[model samples]
Target: MDKRRIGEFEVSAIGLGCMSLSHAYGAPPPRDQAERVLKGALDEGYTFLDTAAVYGLGHNETLVGEVLGDRRGDYVLASKCGLSRGTERELNGHPDILKATCEESLRRLNTEVIDLYYLHRWDRRVPIEDSVGALAELVAQGKIKAIGLSEVSAPTLRRAHATHPIAALQTEYSPWTRNPEIAVLDACRELGVAFVAFSPVGRGFLAGGVRDPAKLEPGDFRSGMPRFQGEAFEANLKLLEALEALATEAACTPAQLCLAWLLQKDPIIVPIPGTARPKHMRENAGAAAVRLTDDIIRRIDEQVNETTVTGSRYAPAMQASVDTERTPAEAAA
Candidate 1:
């Protein structure tokens, strides 16, 4: 795997997201199997691991800690906090709650200091400065090595950076979901912050594993997402056909094609693709080796841009919380 710089630390260009091993995709994999997948990733030279406190409600961190115990320094461990899930699945990011949450994450992760700590979501009630300021304190105390923000807009990113140097910004950025190009990616480039693309394969949909949305379990999170619904799902599958052709030509899987496309987009962009199966894990890791020619990249851009993917990335309520660009009057009000 290739290595890239995220602030001061060097990490694999393709990192493993440990979320699916615990939650979000489907039933949890057995602990031993999940640990094997993690170990395999490290053995294959994936030195960057991403997890969050709320992923399986801290169970994910515990699993990572158990697998990497005592050998933590061998990898760059990145975990997130700040989003509090209440009884009805309400997620909040208040500053005080973030402080308490980070402490809890430290306990669960069993680490003296987290390599990269992030605010999972922006709390509407608290200013971005306050939330980032609290994270700065954690850095001051040696609790965290660097700071990150997730699912935030350019304006909010600038405000948070004024408080401290943010190492990276985590968000969904795939061929199917290209909204970051509107502002977020440009802002990160200007500010010299790394852009971490989560779900770089479009939540496995772009990998050709998800041919039918109806095959998803009833309570699966993707079932509630718009892109996985009836007409939209069918329409999006057509888009994948173009990707499948390119993958075939490239002698790679669709998942790898998608990952390689993102790698070609920006050298600073690191993708954290998640999977619990060892075969899929190895396949994802192999994406770094699939080089894309300039013509292939241009073809991909043209094909993906021509197809209009249906549905919003976030549901209605969650969409309201994303701190996108709003006028000063709207922000103050």
Candidate 2:
């Protein structure tokens, strides 16, 4: 697989989003099975693994540690801090919280130095400088390699970068999820920050895997996303039709086509498409080889245009947690 810069390290263009192995998307694959799947991803050329301290309250990081700890030198490990204990809504980016979180994550990941450490979200209660200053201190201490952010608005990104060079910015940047395009994407480009696209497959909705929200396993996060509920999903599914001809033309699955589209958008854009299935993992990694021509890019634009995208990335309460969009109206506007 080709590599892209996340900081000083060059990671696989198609990184594996390890959250689904234990956090979201219903019951995680059994431990023994998950180990095999993760190993399969590594064998399939994924040198980048993304997890978070908040995911399953550190369960995901532990799983990554247990599976790949022995081969620590094989991949670049990234995790996040700032999420309040056991909750998704509350954020604590205080220096104390960040220091404690960094130590705990190190213990769980079985790594002495986290390759990339991200302030998961902007905390309104905490000043951005304090949070980023702490991260810069961590780099000096050799506790973390590079610093990053998630779902930050353009101004927030600039402010954070001024405190410390933000190596990357992780956010939802799939074809259907265009929030990054509003300003965040361009800001990243201008500042030389690598843009890491999470949920690059639209939680698999854009891949033609999710037909109905009800079909998803109980407790799946997608059920609560505005784009996947009621008329929104029904309308969005129609967008898949626009992708059929292009997928056939590319001789790849709809999911690979989507990955190809993302990779083609910007050399700095790296998509971490997560899946516990070894087959799916291989499929996403293979997308790095998939190429898009001028015509295909135009077709993808038409596909996105064909669907009248509706709904917010999160529910109102969960939406409140995103710093990328200060208000629901602003996101829609």
Best-performing candidate as measured by lDDT:
2
Task: Give the per-residue lDDT of model 1 (tens digit) for 75-173.
Answer: 999998876532123455666677777787787878888999999888877788888988998899899999999989998899999999999999888
lDDT of each: 0.85, 0.86
Which segments of candidate 2 are over 4 A away from where they belong? 86-89, 305-307, 325-333
User: What 10-residue stretch in candidate 1 is worst by lDDT?
Assistant: 324-333
Cα misplacement distance, residue 204 of candidate 1 (Å): 0.3
Stretch of 10 with least lDDT, candidate 2: 324-333
lDDT of 2 at 43: 88
TM-score, model 1 to reference: 0.94
Error of 1 at 165 (Å): 0.9
lDDT of 2: 0.86
Among the numbered candidates, top TM-score falls to 2
Q: In candidate 2, how many Å is residue 214 off?
A: 1.2
